[model samples]
Target: MKVIHLHQEEKKIIEEAVVQNRQAQHKLYVKYAPKMLSVCRQYIKDLQQAEDVMITAFMKVFVNLKYFEHKGSFEGWIRKIMIHECISYLRVKKEMKFVEDEEFTHEMHNNIESQFSVEAIQFLIDALPDGYKMVFNLYVIEGYKHHEIAEMLGISPGTSKSQLSRAREVLQTQINSLNKFNHGTI
Candidate 1:
């Protein structure tokens, strides 16, 4: 097995990229674009828009490359940029509309657990509204707190909590529907 000195290699690449080396910048882009695009898509819901946001974020990454302090994982920094770009794009498009719905039925039916494929999961998430999707992705997937989500999306903590609850309610309903369909009960 070939041992890779990841710290030394990544440090060297980041150092080069910081100095405005085209190859190193290209390397960083190529390494993180796919994941960053997925992050963008989680918010934007349009493949073309996600790609555009990823490219835009990459440009910002390169422009602000000198500010990276190397105190954390480089990919985390890039992901934050992509996420911010996605939020900014959504804001400019006027697509993020949060509804204040506090009436939540926090219950699951049939007590049946079903394994979901990635495509099915994405489909379920894709079916959610923009506000719920954002909250759900941030709170559930990204492991952020309600207050953190609220601050990121410029809303109140209560709004973030409600959005997450609503997203879960919708997803649970969809899952139940899928389960019934799979069991030939639909």
Candidate 2:
């Protein structure tokens, strides 16, 4: 594992928390909760459900603090925990399924060159089917490789790639329509 040098104050807080210091743990929670919650929200649509997942993730973080070897950024470690929690929650709720690559229709070829806002793009992503949305977010937004996504979702790498392709096709179609509508060309 690569050694990561954290700020002295951050290192001190982590050391204290590792010893089960409640105050230090609370400090860590306060510092990371919002960002972790946002990560949870990306996978969970319901706000309350996302909050619950965040809490569960934090609990795991505290319980497993001793296992953290400071090999990477502390925040990255926390983010991984939160992401795992979200994946667990999604697996239980969605029972994610994947179709074989051969089953997918030919990929749609649409050029989407719109000046849509980030909010609009996010809305379109949220509108995707649950499986597609999860795969899309993991691969596109989170920068995870298809094989990594497959491992996380318990699907084959081909399934992950196909889902991502479908997601982009859908997004492109939506963006094109929006662009046309906005330009009065619809």
Question: Which numbered prediction scores highest in TM-score against the true structure?
Answer: 1
Q: Give the TM-score of candidate 2.
A: 0.87
Q: Against the true structure, what is each candidate's TM-score?
A: 0.91, 0.87
lDDT of each: 0.85, 0.84
**Candidate 2 structure quality by residue, lDDT tens digits, 95-154:** 455676735655565555568786677789888878888898897778999889988888
Q: Give me the displacement of residue 79 in model 2, in angstroms.
A: 1.0
User: Which digits, one per residue and each the tens of the lDDT, describe model 1 over residues 1-186?
Assistant: 233577778778888998999999989888888898888878877799889989999999999988989898889988888888888998999989997655544433445476898768888898999999989998777788988888989888888888888888889889988888888997
RMSD of each: 2.5, 3.6
- Model 2 local distance difference test score: 0.84
